[model samples]
Structure formats: structure tokens, C-alpha cells
Target: MAEYKPGEMDISVQEKTFDGFISMVTKGAILCILVLIFMALVNA
Candidate 1:
């Protein structure tokens, strides 16, 4: 296997971390919206 440079590896790691964080935030936001809608429906 080929070896990666420190700077390149750092950037790759950061990109992956950012992507994962964004994904989790998106999922959490969707879940919150769904829950709010459900609660409103139940109340109405």
C-alpha cells in the first residue's frame, strides 16, 4: 500500500469529520421536524 503525507492525511481526516458532522446534524434536524409535526397532529 502507498503511504500518505501528514498534511494530506490531516486534510482527509478533517474532511471526513466535517462530512460526518454535517450528516448527523441533517439527520437530527429532520428528526426534530418530524417529531414536531407529529406532536402538532396529536394535539390538533
Candidate 2:
């Protein structure tokens, strides 16, 4: 049976997930703003 200390792995995975989530959210927000600006320019 493979064994690992769950506590350390859990913390590592949680931090990685949080970092990825923040990056994705930031990128999504920027993309949304860019799209909105493009739409506004097109409408103008």
C-alpha cells in the first residue's frame, strides 16, 4: 500500500487550487472587461 502524510499533501493541494482559482478569476475578469470595451467601441 502506498502511504503519504495526508496533512502535508492536503495543504499543498489546497494552496495550488487556491492559486489556480485566483489566476483564473483574474484572467476572466480582465477578459470580460476587454470584451466590454470592444463592444462599446464597436457600438460607438
Candidate 3:
């Protein structure tokens, strides 16, 4: 087994938060783009 280092857990937590934030932003962007496309199609 690998030795556990101090502060490693904190880094992992931060990484998870960062990943979640990025995922949320990406999803929001995709949703906005999809809505725009749908609106354009309806208006056309």
C-alpha cells in the first residue's frame, strides 16, 4: 500500500469541486446553445 501524505485529502477534495464546477458550466453552456438553436428554428 502507498503511504498517505498530509494535505493529499484536501487536494482531492478541491479537485472534485473543480471537476464538478467545470461539469456544471459545460452543461449550462450546452443547454444555452441548444435553446438558442431551438429558438432560431422556431423563428425561421
Index of the highest-TM-score prediction = 3
TM-score of each: 0.77, 0.76, 0.78
lDDT of each: 0.91, 0.91, 0.93
Q: Could you tell me how far off, in angstroms, the CA of residue 5 lies in candidate 3 after the best superposition?
A: 11
Question: CA lDDT of 31 in candidate 2?
Answer: 100
Residue 23 in candidate 1 has what lDDT?
100
Tens digit per residue, CA lDDT, model 2, 1-44: 87877665547878899999999999999999999999999999
Residues 1-44, model 1: lDDT tens digits: 89967765447878899999999999999999999999999999
Question: How does model 1 score by TM-score?
Answer: 0.77
Clash pairs (backbone) in predicted model 3 = none
Whole-model alpha-carbon lDDT for candidate 1: 0.91
Error of 2 at 41 (Å): 0.4
Candidate RMSDs in order:
4.7, 3.6, 5.1
Q: For model 2, which pairs clash?
A: none
